[model samples]
Target chain A: MKKLWNIFKAGLVTDNPLLILMIGLCSALAVTSTVSNGIGMGLAMTFVLLFSEIFVSTFRKAIPSSVRMPIFLIIIGGFTTIVDLVLKAYFPELSKSMGVFIPLIVVNCIIMGRVEAFSYKQKLVDSIFDALGMGLGYTWVLVGMSAFREVLGNGTFLGVQVMPQSYQPILFFILPPGGFLIFGLFIAFNIWMKNRMALKAEAAAAKENA
Target chain B: MKGNARLGLILAVFAAIGCGTLAVVQGITAPAIAMQSEKALNESLKKLFPEAASFEDITETLKSTSKTVSFEKAYLVKSAAAPLGVAVKAVGSSYGGAAKLLVGVGLTRNIAGVTVLELADTAGLGQNAMNDAYYVNKAEKITFPGQFKGKYLTDAFEVKKDVVAITAATISSKALTEIVKTAADAAAAWLENQAAPVATPADQAAAAASGAPAQAGAAPTGGK
Candidate 1:
């Protein structure tokens, strides 16, 4: 359980797929214009990530080392297709709104990276925890970025008018350039926070030794 | 050799499982997805022509008769007695990509309403065209597709001239206007041909000869 906790912590902060590792930057940037879109995409990614991790780990032994990548792709692609179809059938409006990004989840580097790096080597429970942490980490960053964009860019929170009527929305925050700029700032903040935590831990350890 | 053969078999088994899973999920969701889209289209049509008691899909007939403009589908809306209006589903190239909409033309050759079905325009700028609140606030006085409502079919319908373009979303606004114009012109043409069907060879010859003048008076030829 402690080992599983470590795995989960590692994914959330120490080795975040978006911030630290930066595996799935494309979809992250493209869908971060609104909170709902960000959350929707994050949930979709989580669903795909969690299921693919399980499938990869479950079949780790049977999968040939030589053709393992291809097998992993098959599993990931299958799960993505399921999510895509389910979204289309049930939430048709969201399916239209997300557009091509749902299908593009098949190529998101985070899913492939997790399957290759952790799931292939880790046990099932640890893999699931790692996936949950990484997925949530990715989700929170997306939500944060989208909240900033949606509020500043549109003067609204989740499409509700929050600012005064006089507030003229700065359109820059919701554009493609704004997505990149916000993403870079988020990454820098993540790195700074990690360093600060590390320094604090070292200081505590040094004082204890003294 | 034996180890290589074993790897191939394992890979094949995994592929089979993946394909089987996809097939099952697809089989279950395919019909539902189709129904959803159909329902959405019907709802949009209903919104555009609310008073109409029934809607008859004249997409194939419109396609066959429409000489120049290409529309996805055209529905002939009607009450109990006479034809009420026509709703044409059109797709146009916007800044992002394709933007699809439904334009309703009443029997009097005026726009009843314009409903944007699917738009992939940029988030803040072009997307404002699809925003309901942006067009609904009567205080602001600026509206998106609502500007096109009640517009006569013969009007040039030029963006920034006849209709106000969405701020910073001129491309998307222009694209939607062009699409609506195309649909309106096609519906007008269909109405004209319906009034005077080309049954005889002389009438066909006259239609072919007067096509240029008819297009000019009826539908503006160039993309505004």
Candidate 2:
């Protein structure tokens, strides 16, 4: 259980797909304009990532290294289509808002990276934790960024007007440049948090030694 | 050689499984997807003509006017008592690409409403053309599409000069205005033909040929 928790924590903080690794930044920036879109995209990605990890881990030995890339792609593509179809059928509004980004999930490097680096070698239980941790980590960052952008950019939160009636929305925050601005701030904050944790850990070790 | 062959076999097996799974999922969702689109179309039509009990496709009966704008479909909105108006779906070039719109024109020769079906305009700028919350007149709560309601078919559909353009989205605004105008023109021409008490074969043939009936006196006077 402790080992599982550590693995999950690693995916969440020490090795976040966005803040630390920064593999799939394209969709992250594009869909973070609205809070609902951000949540929708994040959940869709998590669903795909979880299923892909499960399949890859379960069939790791059977999958030959020579043809693993193709196999991985097929699995990933199949899951992405499922997400696309389900969203279109049930959540048509979200499907419309997200547009091509859902299908584009097949190419998101976070899933590919995790499946290749962690799931390919790890046991099923460990892979599951990793997938959950990574998925939530990605979701939280996307939601945080979207919340900031939507409130300031559109003067709304989740399509509801939350800002005062007199507040003038800054359109720049909703554009591509604003995505970069918020993303940079998040990264800087993450780095600062990491440094503080490191300093505290070092001080605890010195106290133990004394 | 044996190892390579084995790898290929495994890859083929995985591909087959993947394809089979997708095929099954697609089969399950295909009907639902079709139903959703149909429902969405119905909802849009209902929103445009709230009193309309039924809509009959009249695309074949009407004639398209603008060379640039293509008329995709037209529907004759009717209540149980009488024909209400016409809804025309038209497509035109926009800043990003093709912009599709549905324009509802009443029998009284005024626009009932307009809704954007598909738009590929830039986010926050051109995209606001369809956003109901992005009010052109914040005090009156008049949206980009809201401004078109009750506008006469003969009114100049020019962006900025007449129609309110989306802020910093003149190209998108112009493209949308043009599409709406083309649709309104088509609806007006069709309505004029419907209102005519008697149509001679020659007049019908001429209307079909020129896309503007010779006896179009009742038609709203407009030139794109």
Candidate 3:
């Protein structure tokens, strides 16, 4: 139980998909336009990541050391394909909204990175916990970024008007450039906070030594 | 294998696998992808004339010939009524790059409506031109394009200021307007040759089947 807790905790904070691990940044940047699109993409990524990671872990011992990377890639590509086909057939609207980015999920560094890094080295149960944590981490960050952009950019929440008429909408919030601007600002702010925490950590370490 | 040799072999194998994976995906998805495109085209027509109980290719003759006609003819997607609208593929340069719209104007020949079947455009601002209320309204309100609705063969094409372009969406407006004019002309030419034979209810069922949406909701590239 303690081991499981450690795995889960590591994934959420220490190696969060967006913050610490910094994988899947492409979709993170592109689809973080609206909460709906973000959530749709997050769910899609979670399912894909969970299955691919598990499948890779299951086959890790079987794969010849000579061709493990190739095998791993084929697995990831196949899973991404199935996701694309299923979504196109069933959830056409979300598929459309996601656009090319859905297919681009095959190239998402996160899926491949986790499978190659942690899952390949870990046990099945540990990997599952890791996947769950990472998935939650991805979903939450995407939702947070999208919520920030949507409300401020559109003057609405989930498409409902939140602000009164007195406020004028900053049309730029919905533009493509605006996405880059907002994401950059958030990333910068996070980096600053991290540096501040690091300084505090160093100060505490110095005081302890003294 | 030595460490360096093994690394090289692994890299080569990985590259081959990536290429092979892409090939397999591109191969299998290619046909489905192409079919989805046809579905999108047909769906666009259906949206314009849902009541269009039926549709037939009156202008398909233009596609058969190898003769170089600078001006290719357009096609008709008729409703169960006397005839619903003119379905034509149009290409124009929008804010970003070349934009393709499948326009189906009313038989009245006025700018009825359109679907940006393909577009590589800036998202949201200039791209909003795909929306009905914006592009369709602006195209028609200007009177040059929409006025074509009810015009006979002799009506010359025109674009006026009243067809107010979206605030920052001029390129899109220009591109669509050009396509509409060419398509309207081609449609008019095709109509002149053909007899106004409206299809019976039996024909409507077949057309309805043909007009159902392509891949329902395919991935959105940059298009709407």
**Rank ordering of all candidates by TM-score, starting from the highest:** 1, 2, 3
Q: Clashing residue pairs, candidate 1?
A: none
The CA-based lDDT of model 1 is what? 0.83
DockQ of each: 0.82, 0.75, 0.14
In terms of lDDT, the poorest run of 10 residues in model 2 chain A is A7-16
For model 1, the superposed segments whose C-alpha errors exceed 4 Å read A207-210, B1-9, B64-70, B136-142, B196-224
* Candidate lDDT values, in order: 0.83, 0.87, 0.64
Better of 1 and 3 by TM-score: 1
TM, every model = 0.88, 0.85, 0.70
| Better lDDT candidate (2, 3) | 2
Model 2, span A109-188: residue lDDT tens: 99999999999999999999999999998999999999999999989999999999899888888988999999999999
When summed lDDT is taken over every stretch of 10 residues in candidate 3 chain B, the lowest stretch is B62-71
Of the candidates shown, which would achieve the greatest DockQ relative to the real structure? Answer: 1
Global fold similarity of model 1 (TM-score): 0.88
lDDT of 3 at A99: 65
